[model samples]
Target: MIYVNEAADPRLDDFRDLTTADRRPDRPGGRGLVIAEGTVVVRRLLASPYRPLAVLGVRRRVEELADDLAELTVPAYVTSSEVMAAVVGFHLNRGVLAVADRVPPPTVESVVADARVLAVLEGVGDHENLGSLFRNAAAFGVDGVLLGPGCADPLYRRSVRVSMGNVLRVPFTALPDWPRALLGLRRRGFTVAALTPRPDAVDLRRLPDGATGRVAVLLGSEGHGLSEQAIAAAELAVRIPMAPGVDSLNVATAAAVAFYELTALAHPGHPAIATPRPRQRTDGGTVGQ
Candidate 1:
């Protein structure tokens, strides 16, 4: 650990002016780095496959990561909160931050191999939605995410923050050949189901029952939803039933519901699906026979 009194220390350059376009890895003139905010996300960054370059935080926040930093040889720069704010161009309420170099993403085939359930996305350019989808994917034991065209970079800072670091854990890769790649998934024995609000879509609850195969739930952007071509590529169209006058749910919110249903459909015995426990009465006996 090194204590730095000045915000201009060359060692802190990676985190400088984070809100600026030039500092955003997904934008022009930006360095391609995976940045993690807060101790929770920073801990996940350290645990991820990406290589940590350095860490910058206030004294307390830096020390809180002592165990995670123990085996690392990278510099952990400790400074006052004021210096941290000045260096980063804004006050980061999360206290600590870590920056890492992104490793190459896994291939689509590698991610798809041995997977029973996947989240396939198209035109999901919104980072938070993408992140939330990843979080839901992680929560339900999704094997991987297949990114179609118009998808945002999952490693972007905002997505990383919104996912609460789950983006680091979920494996994802770009899918080439546009909607045609989806056909490839089907050829690999996947039942590609496109999610849409179209009235003709099959109710999610009515999906054909069988836990004996792979399934990919394809989602689209929040605004336009799925394209006709993408929908055409899918083997089936599915929808979450809604009340009168309701057209659809938010992409990420819809993803959670779809992921839950699909995970149960594809992997009935997967550990994330917990067995229901008996409820007990206040008097200590079971509530029902």
Candidate 2:
């Protein structure tokens, strides 16, 4: 571990002014680095495909991650909480941070080639909602996520934290050409179903028996719901039955309900959705990410 007494040290540049660092194009040093906060997320970053660049933390937080960092050659800067706060420009209760370079995302065909279930998104620009959707997808055994136009960057700092780092684990790729590319999923035998609140839409719980096999769930932003073109492109439209006064659920909550229902129908008795014991980490701590 390297001891850094000063906050302005040149080596700590990556963690400097993090509050404004992630704004794309509008801010200086907004180069889009993959940053993980706290020991849980930092450990997840260490295990992810992204190459770790450096880590900055208080001594106690650094010590807690010793097992995970033992084999890594990345620099671990040790400092007091005051110094860290100065560098990051805020009081970060998470205590530790790790940064990694962004890597090229996988192509749409590659992410979908061997998938049985997928979540396709359109105009989901809210980072927290997008992250929560990924967490739900991971929980229910979604094979991959295909991003249509206007989705937020899943690797954004807030997204990574809100997802509990599940975004790092789930495979996602961008789908170019909007609703037109949805035809590719049809050609590959996926029953693309759009989730909407239309009165005439098929009730989600009563999805037809023919809706089995490979399936793709199309979700849109919470505000406008799906576009007319997107709804028309899908083979079927499905809706979650709700109380009379309720118009719609939050997008992420709606996704969780849909994910559970669809996964139960698609892969009955699948281990992913079954009750399980707490995950044990090799380092003896319970795994949270």
Error of 2 at 250 (Å): 1.0
Task: Report the lDDT tens digits of candidate 1 across residue range 105-167.
Answer: 898879999999999999999989998888899888888999999999898888998998999
Query: Best candidate per lDDT, number?
Result: 2
- Best TM-score goes to which candidate? 1
Candidate 2 at residue 185, lDDT?
90
Model 1, residue 97: C-alpha shift (Å): 0.2
Which stretches of model 2 miss by more than 4 angstroms? 24-30, 274-289
TM-score of 1: 0.91
The lDDT for every candidate, in the order shown, is 0.88, 0.88
Ten-residue stretch with the least lDDT total in model 1: 20-29
TM-scores for every predicted model: 0.91, 0.90
Compute the lDDT of residue 247 as modeled in candidate 1: 61
